[model samples]
Target: MMIVTTDQVAGYEIVEVKGYVKGSTIQTKHIGRDITAGLKGIVGGEIKGYNEMMTEARKLAMHRMVQEAEEKGANAIIGMRMQTSTVMSAAAEIITYGTAVVLEKIN
Candidate 1:
């Protein structure tokens, strides 16, 4: 399936607007990783553990959003966006959402 951040896709015309579709997941920090991250923070550097976690979370969230779009019979998703929020002291929620639509190639 094709996904884009724009309202329109090049070379394809939107045939059907399937409405809004969303997927979300909550991730909590591991204590071991937290300690390591804390140390890295003190030294002012990238935290590998958190980076890996967030990368995985984004992939999962995007996959789930795609699944939802497929269930809605959408061949593409437009205006795709992702957002994050701290849900608790150690947990964060990541959400992916967009407009589901069917696309036909322009000849």
Candidate 2:
């Protein structure tokens, strides 16, 4: 499947609009990692643990979004976007969204 952040994809024409598709997940920081993050805050540096967690969250969310698009019989996804927000202390929500569409290659 092809994915783009814009409304149109190059070398292809959108034939059918499959509407909106989205996927989301919520994650909480592990206590051990949180402790490490708190200590790192004192020195002010990148939090590897938190970084890894968020990275995995993004991958999972994207995978789910793609799965939804496949179910909708979409060959491409346009206007792909990601959103993140703090749901609670030590927890955050990750969301992936896009417009599912069937595309035909332009010859």
Candidate 3:
């Protein structure tokens, strides 16, 4: 499937709107990683553990969104966007959303 941040995909024409599709997941900080993060925070450096966690979470959310689009018979997703929010003290929610659409080559 093709996904783009813009409303239109180059070389393709949108034929049908399958509606909006979204996927979200919540992730919490690991205790061990939190401790390491705290120490790193004191020195002010990149928190690799948390970074990796967020990256994976984003990928999962995007995958789910794509699955939904496919289920709707959409070949592409436009206006794709991602959002991150603090769900709780230790947890964060990642959301991926877009407009599912059928696209045809602009032959």
Best by lDDT: 3
Please state the error at residue 83 of candidate 1 in Å. 0.4
Runs in model 2 with CA error above 4 Å?
Answer: none
Q: In the order shown, what is each candidate's alpha-carbon RMSD?
A: 0.7, 0.7, 0.7
TM-score of each: 0.97, 0.97, 0.97
Question: What lDDT score is found at residue 57 in candidate 2?
Answer: 97
Runs of candidate 1 exceeding 4 Å displacement? none
Checking candidate 3 for backbone clashes, the offending pairs are none
Candidate 2, 3-107: lDDT as tens digits: 899998888899999999998899999999989999998999999999999999999999999999999999889999999999998799999999999999999
Q: Between candidates 1 and 3, which one is better according to lDDT?
A: 3
Ranking by lDDT: 3, 1, 2
lDDT of 2 at 70: 99
Mark the 10 consecutive residues where model 3 has the least summed lDDT. Answer: 6-15
Candidate 3: global Cα-lDDT?
0.96
Worst 10 residues of 2 by lDDT: 1-10
- Candidate 3: where are CA atoms >4 Å away? none
Candidate 1 structure quality by residue, lDDT tens digits, 49-98: 99999999999999999999999999999999999999999999999999
Cα-based lDDT at residue 18, candidate 2: 99
